[model samples]
Target: MATVDRVEIEQAQKLWQPQPGWLNTASYGLPPEPAWTAVQDALADWRVGRTSWEGWGEATERSRAAFANLVGVPVADVATGAVVSQLLAPVAAALPPGATVVAPEVEFTSNLFPWLVQAERGVRVRTVPLAKLVDAIDAGTDLVAFSLVQSADGAVAPYDEIVAAARAHGALVAVDATQACGWLPFDAARADVVVVGAYKWLMAPRGTAFAYLAPDLRDRLRPDAAGWYAGEDPHASYYGPPLRLAADARRFDISPAWFSWVGTAPALDLLAEIGVPAVHEHNVALANRFLAGLGRPPGDSAIVAVEVPGARERLERAGVRAAVRAGRVRASFHVYSTSDDVDLALNALTG
Candidate 1:
């Protein structure tokens, strides 16, 4: 049994400014007051110089530890970054030359392009229909990259089964959790790699992301373009022989957007406080309300898509904010959303 504290959730909402009919957290999440305050505190520390240097380093590691806890992984396994694309490019480069990569055609481009671009290195990126994805992986498959939750229609991938299949074939698994992480819970233990951009459902500022690499997989990867920060001695004053890489996922790390890391640490801390299981419960309850209002069934993820004519104009005229994609009105829900937000979006579509 699991539970979310009502009083705590309401109290948490106070940290966020009220926004009417904003149901697009799947696009970009709004950071709460604490995150902004964290930025100010971080700025103040930097202005003070030497005395605050250790604090800056602590904040960065705090963010890594926070994200690790969020995804149920060890802190050493996680590495922060600027965005999903940048975090994933190295994972793509790590694959053996001429390996075959399988993915969904309708996935978010960040997850798709990195692998597709690998073709230039003799790696083949094959776009498989979702229905055929599990069956597509074989002995020759080097890696299977896909989203835990689809962004457009909010389709949740059957990853456990897929992971089992990929493992059976000795192929690696990498999951893009940008649309899934904070809102839904999954087992990252089964994955070789998990990547997420903090700006989306995690509710952190943009220019922040993290990747989790299983310890064994870390040895297999060769970061195509690592910087000085990616080294074991990131702050080392002098370079020497045997240019050292980090022992864990930090080998894939980059110079994080410092301010973004400041905000992200607090955002992740908030989620950890609320508990992901609780957030998932709240989001699913809101999704149910939105779906019932629209006469649709319980959806796979917090996102519910409906077909409506002139959908964009109607939603705008009614002051409802949602994404119109591929001729479907995609409404996404988060902890901050309420029943009224769902009703308002539904009324605009039905009215």
Candidate 2:
């Protein structure tokens, strides 16, 4: 297991001052001061036309580089977009007719819908329990797509096992890391494609998303959503004609939502500096504390699903923000969460 410095965690914690009862990072992360300030500044600039859009656009590259660093991939392999489905569109479009996709039955729609929509093209999407996901990938499977951490139950995927299985069967691996990327340390390069929504664990504005495309996968897909942003030189491509796209994964890029990227760049940079190992250590510790308080077995994930009666009402009454998913109250801990936040949710449930 990787170890992180307590000092680093402490310094990272100082970047955010979320309210005492924010346990809903699984739904959306509360941005740190820098991210919020960046967004605010960008909005102000937009309102007055005080600065050139070029300055705002620069943030997209910073965000792309930061996300690449966080996922342990080359910057050239990363592409920016507005959402997971948008990022995954090219991958979905690349599937051949009669191809089979295996995914969890309860997967969040962003990861599942794109594949399912391909039914008209003879693209078959097979749904199974998440625990059976690896076993479901076989000779017939063309692709295996799943979330790194389940949104409803907070179950961590068995990543290595799935990757090995996909490799053995020659199936492409597409991962949605929206719920896990910021705090979960894993190599995005292991998969054919990895898409992430920056709003949840990455603590960025909702419109920003990213994808990592392996060299082979990048070559396989068409840049279906290409625009000026996907060009070899965006400013030069503004007028038209030759259609010179980027030679790398940037060819798949969607024009970024500028203010969102401005907010995202600092958030991702902060997470990269703090390191996922440290964030994971802090977040999981708090999650385990909450689980223990509920008299439940400790879990390795930073998100916990509480099934006790009135869990949602109790947390709401106590001003502890959380979400009810699949009939259970989901509470997620992150870099800013502490023992006090866990205790507050515990008291709300048990008191």
The number of the candidate with the highest TM-score is: 2
Over 4 Å off, model 1: 1-4, 43-54, 237-242
Question: What's model 1's overall lDDT?
Answer: 0.84
Clashing pairs in 1: none
Clashes of each: 0, 0
Q: Write the per-residue lDDT of candidate 2 for residues 178-208, one digit (tens) a residue.
A: 9999989999999999999999899998899
* Residue ranges of candidate 2 with Cα displaced over 4 Å: 1-4
Poorest stretch of ten by lDDT in candidate 2: 1-10
The lowest-lDDT stretch of 10 consecutive residues in candidate 1 is: 50-59
Task: Give the alpha carbon lDDT tens digit for every residue of 226-310 in model 1.
Answer: 7777788787713665778777788788876777887888888988988887778778888888887777787657887788888
The global C-alpha lDDT for each of the candidates, from Candidate 1 onward, is 0.84, 0.91
